[model samples]
Each structure stands twice: as structure tokens, then as C-alpha cells.
Target: MRIATYNVNGVNGRLPVLLRWLAETRPDIVCLQELKAPSEKFPAQAIADAGYEAIWHGQKSWNGVAILSRVGTPVETRRGLPDDPDPSQSRYLEAAVAGVLVGGLYLPNGNPRPGPKFDYKLAWFDAFIAHAAELLASGAPVILAGDYNVMPTELDVYKPERWTDDALFAPEVRARYASLRAQGWTDALRHLHPGETIYTFFDYFRNAYARNAGLRIDHLLLSPALAGRLTGAGVDREARGWDKTSDHAPTWIELSEQAPRTRSASGSRPSRAAKPA
Candidate 1:
């Protein structure tokens, strides 16, 4: 099965680009973030027409998340992180699609560090971590996919020195991200291309895409139960170059029907993907 994640920025404004990419790639499941629309204006019919059944949590003019599946209708699991610090914000959405529990999230963009927003970001991360532990304990095949709004390491940033003070790259945020990964969730893309300078998001301005100045913030983390089935992963960099596209591209992982007896570290390969753009 192929699963992908993309931060749409604004579902309504980016519908055309979203549909085009969906049609071209046709992933079995997709996790979308930053819908920036309300529950009533999600354009469900439009998405349905594109051959996907979706479940979404939306808020007005801000954060939102959704899971779309073409293989089967996603069975609703959770709407938001258990005890979300800011339940008012539509950030996390979880569902079961194609036999995998998919968790989609739009983590808070804790900008302007040393403020309530940043504090809330950490609190939310803690809540997510606690809930994730429960999920891991369940021993089910789970894939946590979305825009994490964090650069786990210096390697994930194009110019690490330039973003030291930024909330997304702040030491505290990175530490939390590392701790989450340490809990046994596999960072699928990094597992396939460990040393590659891969990025999933680029700033919309400053000609970031043209210069390949990007960050690998969006991710698809596989639970231990499904990690061995990972066979391929990559970022659809070309999608970012499309007309009026999102700054975030589609990041994906392909999983085999069953786990192998022994998975090789160098066995997985990336699918068709463009150079950083």
C-alpha cells in the first residue's frame, strides 16, 4: 500500500493542485494538513468526485487535518489528540484506512519563541507523546503522517545555522521529536535515504524552491509493527512546482503486502521523484 502526506496550506484555494496531484499519483491513502477551512466548507463532494472517501477535522481560517483513502472508506478513529492542549484548533485527525491506523496532524507552528504559543506547542507535543505511547502499546499497524512542524536534526534543515532561533528548529522542539522517534516509530523516509539531504517543505517566498532551500518537516512515521514492510519512500518534489501549489510536497512510503523475514538496510529504493525544486 502507498500512503502519502501533504500540507495543503488551504484546501479550498489549493483544490485544483490537490486534485491534479491526486489524479497523477493515486496513492492508496493520503493525509492532508492545514486545510484552513471550516467543517462545513471542506468541499467533501469535490474530494469524493476525485475517488476518495475522507474524514476531516476542520476549524475556521486556521488549522485542519484529514485522511483520504481511495482503497476504502476510512473508519473514524480519533478526531484530535487525546486531551489536546488546544482542542479549539483542528490539528490532529486519526482513522483506519486500508487496515492501517493513520494519524494525520498539523502541529502548532509555535512562532515567536518565548511565548504562550511556544509553550502550548510543547504541551501539545507532550499530549501527543502520551497518546502515541498508548497506540504503540496496542501493537497495531500504525502510520503517523503529517506536517510535524519540526526539523528533528540539523540534517533536516537546509541552513541549520540560519534557523537555530526559529521555533521549528528550536532545540526543545527537536528534542521532543527525537524522543518520539526513540519510542520505536520509524522515520520512513530517513530510513530509506539516511544520508540524503531530502526536504519536504520550502518557504513560499525568497525563491526557496528554486534554490532548494527547504526543510524536511512533514513525515510518515511507521510503527514497529509495520516498519519491516516498508519497501520505498520519497518526496514528490515536482508537485511543489505546480501552478499555485503548496509549499509542502507529497511525502510517501510504499509498503509490501507482508513483512520480510529479514529486511536489508540498503534494500529499499525511492520511487519516481524529482530533484529538490
Candidate 2:
């Protein structure tokens, strides 16, 4: 299946670009982040009209997440990270599409480090790492996808030196990401195109896309079992240039149809599987 993830920036402001990409790419499942709209403000009818079913978690003028599936109803599994004791932002949403358990997350963009926001960002990452560990323990074929707001490695970002002090590139943030990956999750793009210069975000102010100077903060990480079935992966750079588009572009991976049929060590198909952004 063609599973894709995108941080649309704002659902209403970029409706046309969103629809156009949906029509052109026709991904079987899509995980959207940063809707920047409230639940009531979500344009559900408009999305449905484009031939997909959606389930979303939204907040006013800020972080939000949603999953749109073409094959099955998107059953909401969770709304926010359970470990978040003071959960106030709508940054996470989980759903089941066809049998895949997809999660859409908009991790905090903790700019201007050494501040309260940066602390919050690290706390959120800790919570996510804990939650991911729980999901991995479920022994499911999981696909955690989203704009993690993290430059995983120097290769993942252009001019890494300039971002050394940035929250996303800080040593602690990278360590957390590494800890999560150590739990058996595979960075799908890196797994397929190790060392390749692929980027999913560009700065409009700097005309970054034209210069191909961008960051690979967006990702689609899957479990080892599912990684073996990854047929291909890519970033849709054209989406960045689309009129009224978000700074972030769409990233996707194609999985072989035969992948899911393989039995796990427990001798049954995984109950939770995902391909979310």
C-alpha cells in the first residue's frame, strides 16, 4: 500500500493544495500533522468528498493530527500520548485503517533552545519514547509517522553546523531518537536509501527548495518485520512548491502486498500495524 505523511501546516488555508496532492498521489492511507484547526473547524466534508475516510484530533490554531484511509473506516484508537500527565496540545492521534494501527504526531518545534519550550520539547520526547516502547511490546507491525521536528543526523539536515544549538539537533534529542530506534523500529527512508540526500522540509524565506537545502525532519519509521517489505520510499518535493503549500512536503513508502501475510513469531498477524505520518 502507498502510505504517506505530511504536515499540511493549516488545513483550511491549504485546502486546494491538499486536495490536489490527494488527487494526484492517491495514497491508500495518509497521516496529516499540524492541521492548525479545531475539531469543529476541520473540513470533514471536503475531505470525504475527495474519496477518503478521516479521523482527527485538532486544537485551535496549533498542533493537530489526523489519518485518512481509503480502504477502511479510521477507528480512533487513542487521542494523545497517555504518559502526558498534563496533556494540553492535540499533537497525537491513533487509528486503525484496515488493520494497521497508524499514529500521526506533530512533535514540538522547540526553537530558541535553553528555554521552557525546549524543556517541554524534551519532556514530550520522553513521553513519546515511553509510549513507543509500549507499542513495540504489543508485538505489532507498527508504523510511526509524522513531522518529528528532529534532524536525526547531520546527513538528514543541510548545514548541520548552523543547527547545532537548535532543540531538534541537540545531543539529547538525537539520543532520544536513537533510544527509540534501538527498540527495533526502522527508519524506513534511511533503511531504503542509506546515505542518500533526501529532504522533506524547506524554508520559504530562504528559497531553500530551489537550492535543495532542506531538512529530513519528517519520517515514516516501521518495525523490522515491516521494513523488509518496504518496496520503495521518496519525498514529494513538488508539493513544497505548490501554491499555498506548507513548508513541509509529503514523504511516503510503498510496501509489497505480500508483506503482511507473513506470520510473526507468535504465529498470527500483528494486531496493531500502521503507516501514519
Leading candidate by TM-score: 1
Error of 2 at 88 (Å): 1.3
Per-residue lDDT of model 1, residues 161-233, tens digit only: 9998899999999999999998999999988887888899989989999899999999989999999999889
Residue 247 lDDT in candidate 2: 95
Query: How many pairs of residues collide in each model?
Result: 0, 4
Q: What lDDT would each prediction earn against the true structure?
A: 0.91, 0.84
TM-score of 2: 0.92
Number of clashing residue pairs, candidate 2: 4
TM-score of 1: 0.97
User: Global lDDT for candidate 2?
Assistant: 0.84
Reference-based lDDT, residue 122, model 2 = 90
Best by lDDT: 1
Deviation in Å, model 2, residue 105 alpha carbon: 0.6
Worst 10 residues of 2 by lDDT: 268-277
lDDT (Cα, tens digit) per residue for candidate 2, span 172-217: 8899899989999988877766757888998987778888888899
